[model samples]
Structures are given as C-alpha cells and as structure tokens.
Target: MKQSDIFRDNADNCLQLAERAEGKPAYKRYSRMADAWTALATEQDWLDGEIPPVKVRVLQMQDT
Candidate 1:
C-alpha cells in the first residue's frame, strides 16, 4: 500500500476514536489528530507526484 493510503487509514482511525470519545476535550483532540493525518496524506500525495501542486498568484500594485 502507498504511504498516503496508510496516512488516510490513520486519519480514519482517529475519526473513529473521536466518535467514541466521552469528553469534549478528548473528542476535539481526536478530531485535530484526524485533520493532521489527512493533511499528511495530502502532502504525501504531492511528494509522490500523484497530483499537480497548487498554483499561487501574485498581485501587482498599481502606481497612483
């Protein structure tokens, strides 16, 4: 399996944990962990060249 897939699996696990969490703090922590894992998976995909990188736009200032 690819590293991104593994990361996504981890994110899924975190979401499951969040669902079962008893307290608000625990739930929030787990949710944050899931988000981080998902971000990692997306970054891994970029590193592996699975998708194109995001394009950035620069704004030019006009002289008054």
Candidate 2:
C-alpha cells in the first residue's frame, strides 16, 4: 500500500525522465511499464498470500 502510494506520487517524475530520454530503449520500456505499474498501484490496498508448513505426529504401536 505505502510503496504503491509512493510510486503514485512519483509518477510525474517517471514521465519526465522518460520524456527527457535518459536512454531511448530504457525510456520506452519504463514508459510502457508505467501503465501496468499504475494498474498494480491502483488494484489493491494491500498484498496477501499464504504459505503453510506441514506437520506430523507419531504414536507408539501396541502389541496385538
């Protein structure tokens, strides 16, 4: 959330850099990514994911 907000605020800076042609190819790539990045910035308030570990229990066997 916070990082994305930071990016939002810096968007103009990105466009300006791209406009200034820091490097033609890199500028085009970054410029293209700007929209996707904007989507990511606007898509969610926070990130969520889950990864769980396995567990096992053992018991002594009784004689038959």
Candidate 3:
C-alpha cells in the first residue's frame, strides 16, 4: 500500500472516531487529525502528478 493510501485510511478512521466521540474536545481533535491526514493525501497526490497545482485568485472587494 502507498503512503497516500495509509493517510487516506487514517483520515477515514479519524472521521469514524469523531462520529463516535461524545465530547466536543475529543470530536474536534479527531476531526483535526482527519483534516491533517487529508492534507497529507493531497500533498502526495500533487507529488504523484495526480492533481494539478491549485491556482489562487485574489478577489477584490468592491464597496457598493
């Protein structure tokens, strides 16, 4: 299994754990862990050329 696969599994596990958690703190922690894992997966995908580089656009706010 690849590193990205591991990260994806871990993220899924974290989400499940979060759902089972009762307290806000525990749930939040698990959710954050899941997010971190997902980020790692995204990085791996980028490195593998599976995903294109994200383009950032700055939108100007106009006052009406």
Candidate 4:
C-alpha cells in the first residue's frame, strides 16, 4: 500500500480505538495519534512526491 494510504488507515484505526477507549487518557492518546497520522497524510499529499529518507545512528551501549 502507498504511504499516504497507510497513514490514512492508521488515522482511521486510531479514531476507532479512540471511540472504544474506556477512559479520557486512552481516548486522548488515540485521538492524538489519529490527528498526527492525518496531518502526516495531508503533508504527504501536498508534497506529491517521494518523501526523503531519514538518517539514523545506532547507539551501542558500552560494556561496563
């Protein structure tokens, strides 16, 4: 599936979860996640191109 589609799906799932949440905290968490996903999808649609890949570094713990 496309990235945009995935984001939209995630948002829908979040909203559904929010609706079924038992408390304010859980509901808010899901709602926020849905908002985040929706925003990402909107931004992706505006970009209309492939999103750039992010670079990451793996941090290794020092042996004590």
The best candidate by TM-score is 1
The parts of candidate 2 lying over 4 Å away from their true place are 1-3, 45-64
lDDT (C-alpha, whole model) for all candidates: 0.99, 0.64, 0.97, 0.91
Candidate 4: worst 10 consecutive residues by lDDT? 46-55
Give the TM-scores of the predictions, in the order they appear.
Answer: 0.89, 0.46, 0.78, 0.71
lDDT-wise, the better of 1 and 3 is 1
Better of 3 and 4 by lDDT: 3
Which segments of model 3 are wrong by more than 4 Å?
56-64
How would you encode candidate 2's per-residue C-alpha lDDT over 1-64 as one tens digit per residue?
Answer: 4767766656656676678776789798768767666656565334522223336788989999
Q: Distance (Å) between predicted and true CA of 1, model 1?
A: 0.2
Looking at model 1, which ten-residue stretch has the lowest summed lDDT? 51-60
CA error at residue 1 for candidate 2, angstroms: 8.9
- Compute the lDDT of residue 30 as modeled in candidate 2: 65
By TM-score: ranked, best first = 1, 3, 4, 2
- For model 4 the local lDDT of residue 63 reads 100
Q: Could you say which candidate leads in lDDT?
A: 1
Model 3 lDDT at residue 13 = 100
Tell me how far the alpha carbon of residue 14 in candidate 4 is from the true structure, in angstroms, after superposition.
0.3
Tens digits of per-residue lDDT, candidate 4, 1-64, equal: 7788899999999999999999999999999999999999978876865655457999999999
